[model samples]
Target: MADKKWMPRWFYQLASPRWCYEITGKLLPLFVIAAILLLVTGTVWALAFAPADYQQGNSFRIIYIHVPSSILAQSCYMLMAVAGAIGLIWKMKVADMVAKCCAPIGASIAVLSLATGAIWGKPTWGSWWVWDARLTSMLILFFLYLGIIALNSAIESERTAAQSTAVLALVGLVNIPIIKYSVDWWNTLHQPATFKLTERPAMPAEMWVPLLVMVIGFYCFFAVAMMLRLRNEIIQRERRSSWVRDLIAG
Candidate 1:
């Protein structure tokens, strides 16, 4: 009784793949609505309403998309790694599915970051590509995401694939800190962080506020995507189960 009281209801429920699928289905619409509203509002506010930068001029506007995507990409990787660890430790199928779903999403966002950075760079750096430390580390991060996806796909056994990818994801954790501090640790074309936990924002309220909104909106968008993919993953993985069969029939 004491153990039961100490344990949370939601934690036990999370062990059920069907429960996760159903709950995610119920939550999906709300996430979609929030993501759409927030992203649209933030993008419009950033592009049209925010004041132009004194140095980079209009080119700095790309930061709205680039920064958010980059931040999300790194964060998503961390989430994937953590989920992978949980799956490996607990042998949780739902957690493995979550880790699997996060890879493609993180990779896509990393690509967006690189593309936008290039677009922002052509004007600022006079070149589309650079061998700078920050750029190189980010490129490596993108490859790491792709590598996990590729490794997972190449393996035939589901459990084996999950374990292998979990190991890889754990090994990749070392790169996150390097990516975060590359600008400071080494001389690079990339500028230092615009938003720092220890310091006030380098930009004015008008600029940073929209960026904040966009960042939050991007996170919401990631959640929406991850949940959608997770639901599909649960269906695929649990297709043989009675609940899934009933869900399909009904």
Candidate 2:
């Protein structure tokens, strides 16, 4: 129905494996365009225009990419877990595809955050990694990502694998809160937040603005990557179906 098409009835209607495939394919290119534009502009602004930190000097510039990627890494797992819950509860094919698509992207972001943190750390803290609560939590998150990817692959049947991994994804989400509040709850070497909504941003506008741009850019990039992967997943899963064959033929 027109109403369904206009609204999010795709949540149910596009559960048709083929419909999900076609629609996500259409969305991929547009997300890619937005992602590239935003990412480039954000990188230039952060790297070139941002002011040097009073303490860290230019080293603090890493925060622009590191914070955004770290935030995305945590948030994306929550998203994947939520999607997994929907897939398990409603048995939706597209929901499972979304969860599948999110795993690697989230993992990659987590790794980037860790690597960048370590690079920043060697200069600031004199070590690449520490067993501090926040750092350890990030390491666990990285493994959690690996676990999800492994589960999705180890299982044989698509439906079975989806269900199994969806459950695992949900389980890992329990750690999200723990990771977030650990710095607040404990005495850690990592600084508490420099940015908050209630308070003015911690840094000068000149520095924070580029960081904000990068955050938005990372989000757009995540969306683009997830959609591209989701489209491929839907297509591969639906490959033998009549609609997919017709779509490819056309």
Candidate 3:
């Protein structure tokens, strides 16, 4: 009771791998349902209802996939770095697991972003690839994700691997701002951001509303994917423990 008074209940609970696994298991279904509903609705609305771009026509429909993937990829890298920091500072196993899980998911999202961006470029820029600032920075971001994944996998010791990856991730923090400001700072072929906090959106309601929905759905999907991977990591890491053995036995 006295120990409980010193620490937040949820924070303490997170230290327990079993608790984390069980809670994530309960939350997984809800995330899946929300992801499916939101994604399907947003996709249909964007593809069928949203008016085509005056400049790009049907090719612009790819923005629904491109923008969300790009946003999620960047966001996921930030989450991974934070998780790595937590694990490094507090030696939290769950945090390390989360950092590990983030790599593949984030990398996949980055790949999707690049693919969609290239496809969007073909019609708008008249090419499949170019070394433009935004595009180059985004490519670098993808390489950074891949580097973290490789670094983590190459190390043998779990603690050492986590620490190494944490340092690498922290260093990669410099790239995030670069990716965000590349278009504004350089003469890039890629367009400026469509959504801005300080300024009104460049797009009207009919175009941006479905995009908003898709962004939210993509975030939900990322959460679902991350939680699933974290749960699996917990099971694998804790397999020799009594609770895990009991869980398996049951």
Candidate 4:
């Protein structure tokens, strides 16, 4: 017999929907607990403990929500596009399912970012909206997410829908960089990124620490949401499978 090929155990497990479902079930509770703890702690720390900005004062507190939502929106879209690409290249149904679940969550997060930005903008700029480069690009990203969701739902064939949405997601990947660099590339009203990997934060630790907590909490929340949606997708698509049937019966 020919020698068996070597593959990572996770690679094999990822190819199995049942394994994905089971593992997500095991992980979901932990993520949920972590999200709740982190979000609550962060919210309290941001609102009550953190010092107000010298410039924006109490209004700056909205950063706790806006910054995290904006970061998560972009991150979620990246994950969705990457998952879609995996589905396209590998023909993995689980990857497609994950990509599908990402759209709605990402869309909602994008909206939250925009809404909070508007609220923050009113005090900072004396206006609710601006035709700034970053804002425009972020709006475009939101539309791209909606387009993917609409395309997926409009197609009749599941495989065709997956393929089409995957292509759309891959094409839309260009917008992410535009959104990130818009402020720097153009004379925009939006401020530069507050947190950069290479430099110290613009704000004091008292402000940035809670923001960091909120960011981590948001990621945990996304994981919890994504896994819940993926689990539901697995059950719905695998309704006829023996394991799923047994699970339902039990």
Off by over 4 Å in 4: 1-7
**Better-scoring candidate (TM-score), 3 or 4:** 4
Clashing pairs in 1: none
The residue pairs that clash in candidate 2, if any, are none
Candidate 3 is scored at a TM of 0.96
Model 3, 1-250: lDDT tens per residue? 1345667789867878999999999999999999999999999999999999998888999999999999999999999999999888778899988999999999999999999999999989999999998888889889989999999889999889999998998899888999899899988888999788899888889999999999999999999999999989999999999999999999
- Please give, for residues 83-118, the per-residue lDDT of candidate 1 as tens digits: 999888767789899999999999999999999999
Cα lDDT tens digits, model 2, 1-250, are 1244455765787567767666767887787887788889878988888778888998988898889998999989998998888888777888889998898999999999999999889889999988888888988999999998998889888889888888888888878887788899898878776567778887788888878878888998898888778878887888898877888899
Q: Candidates 1 and 2: which is better by lDDT? A: 1
* Residue 170, candidate 4: alpha-carbon lDDT: 92
Least accurate stretch of 10 residues (summed lDDT) in model 1?
Answer: 1-10
Q: Pairing residues by index, what is the TM-score of model 1?
A: 0.96
Reference-based TM-score of each model: 0.96, 0.92, 0.96, 0.97
Question: Which is the better candidate, 2 or 3, if ranked by lDDT?
Answer: 3
Candidate 3 segments exceeding 4 Å error: 1-7
